[model samples]
Target: MNLTRTWIALIALSAGSTALAASGLTGRAFALAVLALAWVKAELILRRYLHLARVPAIARGFSLGLAIFLMLAAGLALIPA
Candidate 1:
C-alpha cells in the first residue's frame, strides 16, 4: 500500500481502538481486540514506514516474532491475576 493509504489505515485503526477503549468494555476479548489492532498497526509501520516489505525474509521474521509476542501477551492477559 502507498504511504498515504497506510497512514489513513493507521489513523482509522487508532480511532477504532480509542472508541473501543472508551466504550467501557473489559475482558479478554476486549484485550485481544485491542492487541489485534495494535498488531496490524505495527505491521503497517514495519512494512510501509520502515520499508521492511522490500526484504521478504526479514519481514516474515519480524512478523513471526511479533505474532509470537502478541500471542504470549494475549495468553497472559487471559490469565487471572
Candidate 2:
C-alpha cells in the first residue's frame, strides 16, 4: 500500500473513532465499538506502516495481543461498578 494512502487511512480511522466516542455513546456498546475500531486502526498500522504482512507470525502475534488487551479492557469496563 502507498504510504500516503496508508497515512490518510490512519488519520481517517482515527477521526472516525473520535467522532464515534464524541457522539456520547455509553456503556459496553461504546467500549466494544471503540475497541473494534481501534483494532482496525492497529491492523492498518501493523500491516501497512510496519510491513508486518511480510512476517505473518509477528502480525498474528501483534493482533492477538491487541485483541486480548481490548477484550480485557471491555470486560473490566462492563463489569458492575
Candidate 3:
C-alpha cells in the first residue's frame, strides 16, 4: 500500500477502535474484538511504520509472538466478572 493509504488506514483503525470502546460492548465479545483490533494496529505499525516487512522472517516471528500474547491477554480479560 502507498504510504498515504497506510496512514489513512491507521487513522481509520484508531477511530474505529475508539468507537468500539465507546459503544459499551461488554463481556467476551468485546474483549475479543478489542484484542483483534490491537493485533491489527500492531501489525500496521510493525509493517508500515517500522518497515519490518523488509525482513520477512523477523516479521513473521514478531507477528507470531504478538498474536500469542494478545490472545492470552484477551482470554484473561474475558474471564468472569
Error of 3 at 78 (Å): 3.0
Candidate 3 regions off by >4 Å? none
Worst 10 residues of 3 by lDDT: 29-38
Indicate which candidate wins on TM-score.
1
Pick out the ten consecutive residues of candidate 2 with the lowest summed lDDT. Answer: 27-36
Which candidate achieves the best lDDT against the true structure?
A: 1
Task: Assess each prediction's global lDDT (C-alpha) against the native.
Answer: 0.96, 0.88, 0.89
In model 2, which regions exceed 4 Å deviation? none
Which candidate do you rate higher for TM-score, 2 or 3? 3
TM for every model, in the order presented, reads 0.95, 0.84, 0.89
lDDT tens digits, residue span 1-81, model 2: 788998998899889888998999988888888888888888999998899999999999999998899889888878986
Q: What is the lDDT of candidate 3?
A: 0.89
What are the candidates' C-alpha RMSDs?
0.8, 1.4, 1.2
Give, for candidate 1, the lowest lDDT window spanning 10 residues. Answer: 23-32
